[model samples]
Target: MQQTIEALRVALNKKRWHEARYALSRARALTNALPADVAVQEREQLSALRRMYAARNTPTAKKAQQAKSKAVGRAGGKKPAAKKSTAKSAAQTPKPAPVRDLGDRFINRANLGYGPTNEAKGSRTR
Candidate 1:
C-alpha cells in the first residue's frame, strides 16, 4: 500500500534505514501475489505517476506510447520484401504419343468392339 511505502519513506528520511529497508522488502514480496491485471495497472500507473511527478505534459504520455509502438514496429517492419522471379517459363515439351485432333480416329483397344450379352429369362425345353 502507498501508506506503508510512505511510512517506510518517512522512516528512511528520519535516519531509520533498517526499518525502511525491511518495510520495502515486505512490500516487494507482497507485490508478486497481486492479481495479474493489478500488476499491469500498477506498472502503467507507475509510469503515469512518474510523468506526473516530473510535471510533464499530458501529451508526453501519448508521445511515450507512440514511441513504444514505433519501437515494436521497427523490430519487425523492415523485412526485405520477397521478390518473385518474373521470368516466363518455357513452353512444355511435347508428349511422345501423337496428339489427338478432330479428324483423327480413336482406337479403344480395351473395349475391342465388344458389348454386353443379353441373357433370356425363359425355361429351356428338353
Candidate 2:
C-alpha cells in the first residue's frame, strides 16, 4: 500500500497522468483492505492525489501549458523564421468586376433562376 502511494506521487510529479491514475486506483484498492488506522492515512493521501490530478487535467491548465509552449517555441535554441510579405503591385493585381444593382425587387442573386421569382414586399398576414 505504501509502495503504491509512493508510485502515485512519483507519477504525478513527472506529469505522467495515465500512470498516476493507475497507481491511484491500485492504492485505493489496497487502502480498502488495510487496517482502519492505516486506511485513514492512505485515504488522505489518495484524496490529495485526486485533487492534484483534477487540477492538472482542467481545461484552463491545458490552455496555460499550450500558451507556455508556444511562447517558448519548439525548435530548441533556434529562432523562428520571419514571415515574407505577400503584397502585390497594382499592375500585378486584377481588380474585381463591379456588381450591378438588380433593383430592390430581387431578394437574392441565386434565387433569380430558381424558386419563386419575387418575395412579398411587406409582412404577410395570416
* Highest lDDT model number: 2
> Please, what is the whole-model Cα lDDT of each candidate in the order they appear?
0.55, 0.78
lDDT against true structure, model 2: 0.78
Q: Tens-digit lDDT track for model 1 on 1-126?
A: 566556555665464656766766665665666765676755454444333434333577569867987776455558877976555333556558976686645444335555532334332222
* TM-scores of the models, in the order given: 0.29, 0.45
Clashing pairs counted in every model: 0, 0
Relative to the true structure, candidate 2 reaches a TM of 0.45
User: Quick one: RMSD of model 2?
Assistant: 12.7
Question: Which pairs clash in the backbone of model 2?
Answer: none
Model 2, 12-93: lDDT tens digits are 9899999998998888788777776766777888899888888997898789889987897565788779966566553476
How far off is residue 50 in model 2, in Å?
Answer: 1.3
Off by over 4 Å in 1: 39-126
Error in Å for residue 93 of model 2 = 28
